[model samples]
Target: MKKIISWAIIIYVLYCIGMAWYLFSFADSSIPAEWKGTTADPATFLTPREQVLSEQYSQWKNFLFFVSVPYDWLAYLAVLWLGVAKALQTWSEKATKSFVVQAAFYVFWLSIIMSVLTLPFDFISYRISRAYGVSTQSVFSWMRDETTDFLVNTVMLFLLVVVLYGLIRRFEKRWWLYAWMVSVPFTIFFMFIQPVVIDPLYNNFYPLKDKVLEAKILALAEKADIPSDHVFEVNMSEKTNALNAYVTGIGSHARIVLWDTTLQRLQEKEVLFIMAHEMGHYVMKHVYWGVASYIVLTFAGLFVAGRVMNWLIRRWGEYFHLHKISALASLPLFLLVISVLNFSVSPVVNMVSRYEEHAADEYAIKLTKDADAAISSFQKLTKEGLNQVNPPIIVKIFRYTHPSILERIVFLERIKRGD
Candidate 1:
């Protein structure tokens, strides 16, 4: 029975891979005639070496996409099935009489094991980035970032588990409802603090040094009615060569951040378009909508996951050492179920994200009246990131949160023609 199930899963993984390849292999080769002599044409701008490098990087990214989730599922299953989780449960319980302490201990050990499992792939990804000149971070700095990321994520998970299990013990059947209620405020709090507390941990940030450019960006914000604030910049050149800017945080905590790399790489006009695009996100209320969508999804997912977890515990409690839904051993089962649910909604999330990003592009163009700068900025961004002009359909569906550079550039050109 187990063999049959394993074979079925293997077959399904292959089917999905095949479908992704099918979608990618048929990439739209047709470029509109108007874009022929422009930077919008990949061939016009990309050197032969750049084209080869981008293609190679794209393939590596797609390979990782194919393997990442299945690898995670397998890693978690191994910990569960090989009795590591059960042993941790036993040890954590023996270590403390406090249920909360046990939960924390279990979470810590589970995170360590998961990190170990993920490290090889993570290192592979890092090494590949270095090879492609995408990341300039030193090995020590990269390792430091990884450790900090793991610790931060583990602490968050531990807190969430404490809340989840405490509610389960108290409410039992209605735990999901309470969890959702708790999560809404918790999510907002995290976002509010992230830009202030969490962001500074990874990189140094300060007020933008270019006073003249800062004035322009601030004026643009005023025009957009997003409230005036200081524009900030982060030291990004220490880690990567990628150029990016975004509006992060909520309420008074909100600020626009530019990667120092962006300032160095782009012209002043191009930088304005990028910053204007980030402001568009605020003007369009993408952040609020995103938070609302996450809240809605979690409510439904939690209810469904609770049902699935309860069913699994009822059926195979003793077999898997999961005698109760609240048992520390069952965290893996809960996570596995929740992960599957997340995958189910991944496309919808990406779809909304893409729409918001495309809207932001148009908004930036209209606000700045610099279709040329937007086009050039996007083209430079693609080159810096080594992103393909147009990814495969499957990649677009699963990975892209913004319209393809090809589409974005073409749209800008169309508007330029009308102008």
Candidate 2:
């Protein structure tokens, strides 16, 4: 068991290194030419929007701001390793009865430590957003957001740890089956409660008012054959300047949410394109498939984790200052398992999501022949969000959930050319 765990750890670490290398290599080679633009001066590259945002939050103090990016990255990696190691050690012991008790302690302690470590960057990000007129919240508001996030995360962590430990204890041989059984209920519960219960605590949501716009949106849904009852608008502008639209829930519970920021800035045609794109997700049944994929991946992860957890506990348990096999101590093991799964399958997942996005974009273009409107909307979105127009292929494969702006523009241009 000890040998198995050591091998697993070594293999996992090697896999992570390999993934990082692959990502960096791809970024260097596959970055699109159109996305790379030269500036007459370095300052010419800084968009007015970026400048305003930077100036606004410049007052916020960041202790770690002085640290180089590479150092920050190393610090993050170290924290993740420590947290995971501590968690796995606690979970591998036979003495622990209640994973919840263990996980709570682990989450509480780790969150505080991580929060302190991340404070400088967090404050800088908040201040930057505020400076750009993208964020409405004051410092108090930022603190409140953090507090709420901490509480929610703690609860979720406790639940997940308890459930995972229970599965490993009872169904060690069939951990994957147990995990799948647990996930179905949890996913359904999350879907049902998230919009009405969880979201309301974070941001205000008022029913959309424009009767003309409402009718137009509803008509698009009807044309797409999506139920009218599922169409809704949210006043997300109060929270952030970012624009977004998403399709949530499944079947009867499925609904659409469009941010007020999207509506406020975009023309009617642009809004329609966005709506059509989201509706495409629902129409294509991507949400159901995505959840199903997660369940499969979760099961695979638990099976892999179960195979090597005992050995890890025996070897690294003392080093991480942990005793027993509880959920709390086993977090690092869990994270390592998850990271392996992600590293191995991320490109496949990205391919799936990108395909859906492209399909949605196609649907949007079909609904509105306003290629110019689509192009302008994408430009506005990328600019407002301070997104890179073109990112390295490795970054896209590893990090991006959506295609880059340049890719979207190229696709749209291709559609225009009937190629």
Candidate 3:
């Protein structure tokens, strides 16, 4: 017991050290002064009031960044520490003789407990977004969304848990390999269906309504040689005023979506640039590469988890209230390792994402040949999103999937200048 508690404390201490390290790393990280031009600097993108709001929003986002990872780690830890994991396992067994039912039962309760434990961090984020005039959701509506989210997550988790534990029972030594083998297809299927199945549960999606704009976007797609019928738009203005557009799904299911907020706020040219950027993802086969990356990360993560789970159980099985790594009670420990692993690898993932986004941006500019439109579109994005033009290095590494707004706009500004 003492050993387990000691290790937990040690892990948390190391997490604290990592948080500090990220801050220090950000301090040392710097971008080129030349990127900040005399006429069209990133800082010049925001007005005085917007600068204040952006700074405030950045501070809150950074605070969330520091706590969110730890919150996930501690949720798993709390379940294990408080005996909820063992209790839930026992209850699931007592409730059903069937293995599938037991898996579903256990996963459902475990997910709920973790959600309840971690709800505050998410609630804080919502409240922060609301306070900043970024979220239009009411408290009840927000809670409904949260509930819908966890229920969906629980169902997906139940499926994965059944496969994982079933593999463990059948081939204890090679369960990780088998589980990952299953996951590659499972992940692809999920990605393929998400735009059609899971996404619609949250918001309405339909063809972009404006015929003139849709025709222009389809022309842009044809110019890029992207096979598409029509542009899709989601009712984002119903939720928030933030502007966003992206490519989702894979292959035939693949389509570009623009937010109605974006369409309403930007000019026709700016909107086309946004759609062109999304088309670039399809043109470059980023979805396939992204899936490949996810599969590789899962393979490595599962392998490490298998090794670590066995070591911990071997050393302190009794302390953990479990006799073997395959026991359902050991799940929290397994997930704890995975949570830490994912957090540790996130910077590398985000780095790749930033690169992809940059490539897409370049593709969009080339296809549109409208650097002025691209620059102004980004500036508008920065304003509506309350995005800090020059965020610290820590944010650049962990939170940002796209290059910073300042970086994108400045790059396009250079293109406009022929520099």
C-alpha lDDT values of all predictions: 0.86, 0.66, 0.83
**What's the CA RMSD for each of the models?**
2.3, 6.7, 2.7
Give candidate 3 misplaced runs (Cα > 4 Å).
Answer: 1-43
Give lDDT for model 2: 0.66
Question: What's the ranking of the predictions by lDDT, best on top?
Answer: 1, 3, 2
TM for candidate 2 is 0.76
Q: Compared with the true structure, what per-residue lDDT tens digits does model 1 show for residues 1-419?
A: 36744874797688667755654464553356876778688778789799878877887867676677777777776677677889999999999999989989999999999999989989999999999999999999999999999999999999999999899889988999999999999999988888889999899999888888888888888899877654689999999988898878887888788999999999989999999999899888788888889999999999999999889778866556677887778888888888889887888899999899999998998899998899889988988989888777767877888888998988898898895
Best by TM-score: 1
- Which stretches in model 2 have alpha-carbon errors above 4 Å? 1-107, 131-136, 171-173, 321-328
lDDT of 2 by residue, 102-209 (tens): 556666666666567667777877776776666777788779889998888778877777677677667756765777788887887787667777877777765567
Off by over 4 Å in 1: 1-37, 316-319
Can you give the lDDT of residue 22 in candidate 2? 46
Give candidate 3's whole-model lDDT.
0.83
lDDT of 3 by residue, 124-233 (tens): 99888888888787898788889889989899888888889999999989999999999999999999998999989888999989988888888888888877563689
